[model samples]
Target: MTTAMGAALRRIQLGNALSAFGNGFTIPYLFVYVSQVRNLGASTAGVVLATLAVAALLVLPLTGRVIDRRGPLPVAIAGTVSAAVGSLGLGFADSKVLVVAAAAALGAGFAVIQPALATMIVWCSTPTTRSRAFAMQFFLNNLGLGIGGLLGGQLVDPSNASSFVRLFAIESAMFLVLGVAVATVRLPKAPRLGDVVPAGEGAKGGWRSLLGDRAMVQLCVLGFVMFFACYGQFESGLAAFAVEVTRISPATLGIALAANTAAIVLTQFAVLRLVDGRRRSRVVALVGLIWTVAWIAAGVSGLVPGAHGVATALLISTYALFGIGESMLAPTVAPLVADLAPARLVGQYNSAFALVKQLAMAVGPAVGGLMAGGGMYGAYIVLLIVCALGITALALRLGRRLTPEQDNPRLLARRSEPVAGSAAAPAPVACSASH
Candidate 1:
């Protein structure tokens, strides 16, 4: 990568870390703050939580169009500002309507930030550097979240409602800071479909164009199941299962989460190396297998009629294994999304995938929670195990659809070397962000 690209990437990563850090303060504590501190009751708090998801669903399609038309930087700035306002508002909202409205703003901002940031990464990095860039993004995200959560825990006081307000104010400040930081970054010009095709030939059909790609469609499906079976369960369904079935203590649950985060921070680079140059689909399939084993371990933790120590060990091991799978996916899935896009449609594709993820996360907890809570623990584990197997099957099929260059990018880099009569590839250029 050129020095300019390097500088741009650093700015982007810094922005990512700041946004994630701010988010950590609210994500882990929102339900508690709303339900207990505000005395809105659990049902109201649940509605507030659901409002975030509903708002994302409402706005994401439009956000994708805006990103595709306007470029990512402006969209990112807008998202951050919206999030800052919503976060600050949330601190003061007492009425149910006000709380939900603030949550809607926060959710819309959060939803847009993802694709905007992802598109910026694509514009900033060459294909050779892209995987590592995304891996670093994942690493910093986890690190920021871990540190933020740790600090947030120290700042929050269950007995004092005002303490929760202080936490929200800090989170809002971080969002504003991130917005200012990223606003200064200069990114490469985004290529549009019009740039690559005849005028009016390809600019008309937006998401319809994206949905036409069979591989992308299948990949979106895979992503949905992947998130549903894993991320969706992390805090809600999985935690409830541990509590009700395995009798896991709160202290042990914290340890398990720490193990997951630690494992990702430590293993992300190493796992990236293992996945680099390999077929991405195969690597994804391997993650599925790893997670299947994780679910089995989770099942064993609950079913084993033995010492408490053994069950705790198994539960922690399950989280660690999930972390390992996450580490592998960090490099594999996101870069593939960028590679699959038609140059100008990167934002649209990214937003579509993000929407799928949100949907999965929204549904996964509810389904997993119901199953685990309704004395259907065995069925819950079995369903996720099947989902894991489905990931493996679908990935192999998707691999068949990808060209050699799409599946193995290292080979693409090697093969792209200048030939005797060929012109050299253009140098990376830095473009100013749109106002």
Candidate 2:
């Protein structure tokens, strides 16, 4: 990477870390603030929570097109602005309409930022460095959230409404900081929609063009199951399961969540080393195997029969195992998305994948909650186990469809290097992210 690009990436990472720190202060408390503090009731809190996903679904279709046309920097800035206003608004909102509206803005902003920031990272890094770039982003995100959650927990007071407002204020400020940090970045020259193809190409058939890529479509399917089987359950389904069937305490559940973040923070770099240069599909498949084990452990936690200590251990391990799998995916799935995208449509592909993630997140919780809530604990665990296995199968299938370079950029990079005693090595495969 050039010094300029390196510097730019650092700025983005720092801003992201700080922004995540701010988010940590509020994420765990939003439902409580709405339902209890504002006296909006549980149903209203549910609406507020659902509004985030609903708003993301409503706005994401247009996000990619905006990023493709206006560029990621401006789009990223806009996202931060929207999120900032929403965050600040949440601090002061007392009524249901005000709270839900603020949540919609916050959700829409966050959704826009996903693809916008991803496209920025793509523009800043080469194919070889892309994995590490994404890995670092995931690392910082988890790390920031972990640290923020820790501090926020210390400050939270169920009896004190002002404390919740303070948390939201900090989150809002961090979004503004992210905006400033991104606005100053000087990226390497990259092709926009016009430069990569004709001026109207993006508009003419952007979504159609993306859907036309067979590999990308298959990958989206894989992406949905991947998120559904794991992240989708973190707060809702998994938390409920831990507390109910597993009979774990709320405090223990918090510990389990901490363990998950701890696993990711400690293992992200190590997992990156193991996955680097390997086929991304294989790495993702490995994550599926790891999570399959996690879900089975989750199932066992409930069945362990009066061994409270044993059941708690199993539940925590279940979360930790999922964290390990997440660390692996950090370097695998996202860079592959970038590699699969056409240069001009990187934003489109990123947004589409983000949309898939949102859909899975929305559905996964509903299903998990219903099954778990309806005395279907056995079925809930079984369903997740099946989804985990599906990840492995879908990934291997997608592997067959990727180009050599797209599947394993490191191997291609090695091939392009001249041998020690030879004039040159074989030319690198043509497939590469056009950053």
Candidate 3:
């Protein structure tokens, strides 16, 4: 790569890392604050978080349109500013109603950030290099999450609201800083809608066109299920399970999450290089199997002698497997989405992708919380089935839709070749919020 290209890539990576840090810095604490400090039940917290997701879901598609019409940098600037304001509001909230409102604003800001960042990433690289770009983004994202968890753990004082508020204030400041950084970066102009030739032109289409594509739809469905299984374990159940079944302290749980983050950061590139696009289906299937086994082992670890340590190990292993799976899934999925989408409707395609995932994010916690409340075992059982089903569905769908040619590494390398008469060359679009 040229020095200029390398510099640009580094800048993109830096932007992504900062964005990830801003996101993670406040979120772990937000959940803990809502549940523990505010004295709300797990299910109630889930509902509140889910409501924020719903707000994101409502706005996410519109953000895609905005990115298509305007440029990515402007949207990113708006999003970061909004997120900062929302985080500050969340810090000041004194009532449930106010908290939920602030959370919704935060979610909306995130929704705006998602597509703009994604489009920028997509625009940055050739298809072959896009996977590595995404892997870097994913790695930084997890690393940031780890750092945030450690920071939150150190900062949180159950008896002290002042400390909690102060941490949130820091997070708010970080968001504003990130927004400014986004504004400083140079990005290519977005393509005009009329410039690109629409794919699947004969089909009656709007969102329906994007949704009706068999492979794209199946991928989205699988994404929903996969994320539902993985995120559910952490968001709704882990802390309670640690306390009740493993007899571990909140601090230990925080440490374990930090460990998970470290594992993600250290191993993501190695895992990404290993999985590569040609083997994505197999990799995904293997990841599902690993996750299922991890969950089962986690459940049974509770029955082991020295249950706390065993359960912690099992859970950490589960997260490690998730990180590996995510490494593979994140890179491959975007290229696949781009492949399936009408070239002219990149915004719609990106939006639909974000929309489905956000919808799942909205629903998964509430459902998982309900099952977990029944029993930790019940929650694991539900997650196991979901993961297994998602794997099966992804394998079958991709097997049918993706030909040997599509899966061929040589063909993938040729992805940067422009479709004849297409409006413009395809760009590397990374959907950052997909994390």
**Index of the highest-lDDT prediction:** 2
Better model by TM-score: candidate 1 vs candidate 2: 1
Badly placed stretches (over 4 Å) of model 1 are 192-204, 419-423, 431-435
Query: Could you estimate the TM-score for every candidate?
Result: 0.96, 0.95, 0.83
* Ten residues in sequence with the least summed lDDT for candidate 3: 426-435
Q: What lDDT does the true structure give each of the candidates?
A: 0.87, 0.89, 0.67
- Ten residues in a row with the worst lDDT in model 2? 426-435
Clashing residue pairs in all predictions, respectively, total: 0, 0, 7
Give residue 266's lDDT in candidate 3 (0 to 100): 74
**Could you give candidate 3's per-residue lDDT for residues 1-435 as a string of tens digits?**
234444555665676676666566577667667777777656656666776787788887676556655667788788878777878887787677777887888888877776666666666665566677777777777776667656776877977777778877877887777676566556555454564435644323556666667777777877777777776557666545555666667767666666666667777777776767565556667767767676675566566646556767775666566656666666666655655655455666777788877777666666666666877555556566567656756765675776554443446566656789977755443322210
Instruction: Tell me model 2's lDDT, rounded to 2 decimals.
Output: 0.89
Q: Give the better candidate number (1 or 3) by lDDT.
A: 1
Better of 1 and 2 by lDDT: 2
Which residue runs of candidate 2 sit more than 4 Å off their true CA positions? 192-195, 202-204, 418-435
**Candidate 3 error regions (>4 Å):** 1-6, 31-48, 95-97, 190-205, 238-249, 305-312, 376-379, 382-386, 403-410, 414-435
